[model samples]
Target chain A: MASPIQENLVSKNAEYASKFTKGDLALPPAKHYLVLTCMDARIDPAAAFGIDLGDAHVIRNAGGSARDALRSIIISQQLLGTKEIILIKHTGCGMLTFSNEDAHGLVKKNLGPSAAAEIATLDFLPIKNLDDAVKGDVEYLKRSAAVPEDVIISGWVYEVETGKVRRIV
Target chain B: MASPIQENLVSKNAEYASKFTKGDLALPPAKHYLVLTCMDARIDPAAAFGIDLGDAHVIRNAGGSARDALRSIIISQQLLGTKEIILIKHTGCGMLTFSNEDAHGLVKKNLGPSAAAEIATLDFLPIKNLDDAVKGDVEYLKRSAAVPEDVIISGWVYEVETGKVRRIV
Candidate 1:
């Protein structure tokens, strides 16, 4: 006997799986380009880059910090066979609002002191300028990770107000 | 004297930063939910979960596998002060198209024999069933690394065909 939650889950899964016929499935490209960007509503990668649905792998996080996106970067390159990486940090990011002290206080208030302490020790790469931040992130990916030397790593800044992307480095 | 690349980067950064005033900044929140999903074009968490920008930290990857997004997840939780984690894997993923053998062959052919050898050792968790996969990933997150036990971890499967999400235990 299935619980109500389990039954609901099965129904939902069945509906989602219905679109695909097993015979119609095709493998994705071996070499993929992974883009690490911010989840800001203003920065639209598809429109700016003229990217289609299946063209590039986009990994988005807060502030579009490459340090935050490093794990996915490794997996995308090593396990998923992506060669190129593009770090797209944008202007008007919410990350620039708070200091490390504010972050610690918030964690302690909501999650308790123990979790807050753990958070304090974590490294956060701050951005003074969006273009420099994007470039630095690209450099970090190239140098810190196991990405191939020939990998075309690039950095770009998406202007939130103007809806333009300028390749930084 | 700055290189051409550095000069271009500096000018672009200055141009973008000029649009923002000091008042546009928002204070950091008391708690953050770090979410990991896939780069599948069909899945949209904001519409499904009613989460706005700056509400939760979302990290996306190719398979929506936790291992692939582990680095971003760590940074979001540890550095950015997110207390809870929600790992979402969706149905009808492109990742399920290729078997491990096929992936190995493709990487070998394109990248090189050594690259293929390295990729073969990588643990790319493939899921035939979406619900089971979500639950399994949640369990994996609990066991692996420095993830907090009391972090209120949960897993959900987003059905691409129907824009609906089913919470999996």
Candidate 2:
């Protein structure tokens, strides 16, 4: 038996799925480059970078941390056939707002104490420095056995107010 | 010394970063949610799902396949403290166009035979069925030891033509 919320979601999904024919939405070859960045409201990859719809693969996350977007990067490059990767971390990012302690407290309050404690132990959370964070992420990518050595990997910081991207390392 | 291409990118990124104040960005909590979906021009998660800035993290990939977005997911949830996850695979996805053999051949011709072979072995590429793909991604989220059991995992297929999201079990 499904909850009321789940039931409602199912009905809505079915209705949405009915509107499209299989032929209309065909996938394209995995050519071009891949970009990993933040999902902040102010940053627009298309306008800022002049990226068209079919040109590159974009993966956005909080803080634009490369570590956070690594899994997607592997799949995009190893599986999807992309050769170039651009990682864009941004200024005024929501990620730089909280500390590990604050996050642990929030998680404990919203989830549970145990869950919060578990999160604090992970090496990937609560980035202390922005420049170091970007450098660390680039290093991680470079060291990853899955990522090809020839794949061009670059890092940048996007300024939300100016709509520009600045390469950091 | 940076190359001409690297120098150009750095300038663009710095231009954007200059617009933000030190206080504009908020740091994330210990636990956050990272969402991976398609960049279908039609799906507006902000309007439809009511996701606001500084809310759940969003990572947009080509087809929302776990395999393609796996590295991102791992970093977001594991390092960023995201506990809940939503994987949105949409209807009329471009991923449905090429078969495994075709994708391999294209990569071989454009990139190299070894690169193509690498692509063929990845679990996330060349989705066979949309429904199955959604189910498989959810299952991967649930079964992965890296992901917590309590993580509220859901999968949906968004219809590009109708702008509706269909929940897939």
| Model 1 / residue A100 / CA error / Å | 3.3
> Model 2, range A1-169, lDDT digits (tens) per residue?
5543344445655554455343243243234577777755555565465454445667775566666555456555645566777788777555666665665555566646555555566433556677778888889888765577888888777665456666677
Candidate 2 stretches with Cα past 4 Å from truth are: A1-31, A99-102, A113-121, B1-35, B38-57, B61-87, B91-129, B132-155, B159-169
- Candidate 1 is graded, for docking, as incorrect
* Candidate 1 local lDDT, residue B109: 66
Interface alpha-carbon RMSD, every candidate: 8.2, 7.2
Q: List ranges where model 1 is wrong by over 4 Å.
A: A1-31, B1-35, B41-57, B62-87, B92-130, B136-154, B159-165
Prediction 2 TM-score vs. true? 0.59
lDDT of 1 at B161: 52
All candidates: TM-score: 0.60, 0.59
Model 1 TM-score is 0.60
